[model samples]
Target: MSELTAFLSSNVVFGVWGGLVGLSLLVLAVDLHQKNAHLSPMMKFVWALTVLYSGPIGLGIYFYAGRKEIAHDSIWRRGFRSVAHCYSGCGMGEVLGVILTVGLLSLGNLWVALASFSLAYVFGFGLTMGPLMQEGETFSDAFNDALYSETPSITVMEVVAIGADLLLAGSAHMGQTLFWGALIFSLSLGLFAAYPVNVLLIKWGVKEGMMNPKHTPGNAAPQTA
Candidate 1:
């Protein structure tokens, strides 16, 4: 208790959290105001959630993942793009689960964590499947792709993100600022932690850039454009 108190009271903690969250919002604003990209409504929503969870890293995620359209023929480059793909769905789902289970439902930490994990996986799989289906693939094909790809990708992310969230939440700060700060930090933490697993998955050809439906051959451009 005393250690937590000391940690929270430190200036470094405030600076780190504030900087990350502020950067996240700034990144989101840029994505919103940029006129040239002309993202779809669904993509706008997806990037919004990415910014919300990604914190400072949100800026780079937007750059490498969405704005640049996850274009990479190289194996290593594809790996990061794959992580970006998985991160979006997992980020959105985990945040909602955390808020629902911990914030609204007032459940215990155990329940909160469980809910976060479940929701993350569900959202992750759905988002991954969407692009495949849009590529004129069958439901079964998309489902199998999602199951094989997003499962491991999201699992690594959720475990790391939830672990960080629970750790910070357990510190007993009842303030809204502190809770949100922890969440933002957890998002950044999850990104770094999940990178290696994503790299392996990409290298093994399990998943890569499936979030950008355009990346799939024959669906490389919008239907109208």
Candidate 2:
């Protein structure tokens, strides 16, 4: 009983952020309602969980990596693959940010977030362009594609994720579990907030997913859906 009291009383900020999270969850429940016909039970769970965990990046990856089959050469699959590819780059950038934040330099929370956000988008665009270049896309053409496609999703993700971290942490030191837990929890909220926007992107037929990107030239990148 005392433990429960400690838990409830300690995280006042967490509770506030959690209210926002709850709102996102409500939004997700409604938005995903009609999407049920379009995806399998498992795929639906995958999509929901991805949103629950990683927000835009995970949503893009779901399409990019071909989590579900829409049809052969379906726009849905192609779009997902494209988004996933961008997320791959973002993932790399976030890794570097983590290194800067706590691993290599311990530059504190502010620098860590700034580094992560800036690097994530930068790497997201670059990574997308890299594969397109190998596929015979020129720098100009690839640049346009990367910038246009990834901007919306990545922006949504970074804003929400960063906002959550700062709100939860405030002035707290990084070594504490509460700080870390709040960050994770805040990300889940971010995912919830971003899920609907991703769904709209998928619906617009402007995106696609592939089973895998065969890094080598002359190898056909197989379509998963």
Query: Top TM-score: which candidate number?
Result: 1
Error of 2 at 103 (Å): 5.7
For model 2, residues 144-218, the per-residue Cα lDDT tens digits are: 987876778777766776666666654444566555555555555544454455556767754443333223223
Give the TM-scores of the predictions, in the order they appear: 0.74, 0.53
Model 2: worst 10 consecutive residues (lDDT sum): 209-218
Off by over 4 Å in 1: 1-46, 64-73, 171-176, 210-225
- In each prediction, how many residue pairs overlap at the backbone (N, C-alpha, C within less than 3 A)? 0, 16
Q: 64-130 in candidate 1: lDDT tens per residue?
A: 6555354544555556656766778888788888888767777888887898898888888888778
Clashing pairs in 1: none
* Cα error of candidate 2 at position 179, Å: 3.9
**lDDT over C-alpha atoms for residue 86 of model 2:** 46
